[model samples]
Target: MTLPDTPEQTPLTADTVLRYHLCWKHRDLDGVMALYHPDIQYHDFFQNRVLGFDELRDYVRASLPHAAGEDIVHSDRIRVDGCTAFIQYQVTVQGGDGLVAFQSSEAITVKDGLIWRINEYATLVRRNAKGSDRSSPRPATSRLGLSPRQLSTMAQDLEHYFQRQRPYLDPELDLQQVAEASGYSRNQISYLLNQVLGQSFYRYVNQARLQHLLASLDDSCTRMPVDDLAFAAGFNSLSAFYKCFREHTGLSPKAYVKQISLRART
Candidate 1:
């Protein structure tokens, strides 16, 4: 797995790579996306270039259905340069007629400490392996028996939902609503957010709302009142808003707003 020749750089360790792989296997999109640079440019194997955060978000969302719950496996690092690295892997997805479709020789490019692009040059290694059945029963309870691939798909879907719908604005939003929006059930959503991601539903929603409020404060043209902004960000009460704001940003809403205003002035 020789990386392209580039300037000398520190390569990410195997442990780091394994950790990232587990995060992906866990279908933690937010966890995965946090690794990439904000201004990433993704080049697909089909020569499609996805530019910017929003574009990457959409591209990933659209690709999820095809890749979810597949037998994806990654191999050792090929090479690394400053802020860039590469890895090789193979993936097997269930195909029509109960066949196992294998894709080999996949390559991934990580830039600025995140996966910037993936170029898969693959062929079907084998087909029709035993026990390659695709059909499975959906979980009866809230917990979806989602493989890593399915969770990855759900995570991507949730990311798009967050960007487009801005569900964080409803402080009362719960696992059921989020599950409905993300096409999972209440139990599955609860398990993903609570067990997998290690965060409660309310905490996750509050964090998202706080982040939304922070972004709103960054807007130059909008001068929103604190109380209105709090409600708009989906905080049920002023006190809760204040408490969450302070906890998340380590500053009161007023102070955070003032800081943003000051930063904007500079």
Candidate 2:
């Protein structure tokens, strides 16, 4: 007796399947979403089947935020027909509290240039020896893993960069420039800001400028007007300066100055 082939055997074209995989790997939710029909249905290893556009949209929004690094090893494709395709791939994710190493399998189904469904099966693989096993543990590098000399160098570079570049005025100040100037990679900069500094890039730059502004305010010899002082402090706009100033100092710039003036008189 001869056994029949499995229903999971689906034929897919190379071009269509490669495009789907590219979109997924790039984390382009919009591109991936566009590949799905309005009435698409999808199922994952979680035993949940998402149906319709709204449900899929919400699911993607909620899940994408948790997605981190991707290390995919192999991806292959087959076309069942002109309208249907399947792709199989192995992916590794950083696990541990600091995102270490976890491996998984992903299967994507595309129909008529849209993703009809996706099935992913992920399993915990290994933990980093230096990283925490907690869900949201900071990276080991942030815990002073570097030598004392290296730490001192990094701190000195960070301070000097802030003083020299004055990145606050440039809204486009990004990790690449900072890393290059500090002799670090973009990943190193990101790790420094996220893990060591415990702040986002925008917040870190703004806080540094805000501190400088506060110091300047304490010196009466500087005769620049309040608005001019704000701009000179690297704030691009008066409104943004006032907003961040209030947030950092718990008082408007004018109010803070008045309080300082009154205190000095007393």
Off by over 4 Å in 1: 1-143
Residue 118's lDDT within candidate 1 is 50
lDDT of each: 0.57, 0.56
Model 2 residue 170 CA deviation (Å) reads 5.3
| lDDT of model 2, residue 163 | 76
lDDT of candidate 1 at residue 19, scale 0 to 100: 56
Query: What would the TM-scores of all predictions be?
Result: 0.48, 0.42
Clash totals for all candidate models: 5, 12
Per-residue lDDT tens digits of candidate 1, residues 53-110?
A: 7765544443344434545666554554543445665544321123333233434455
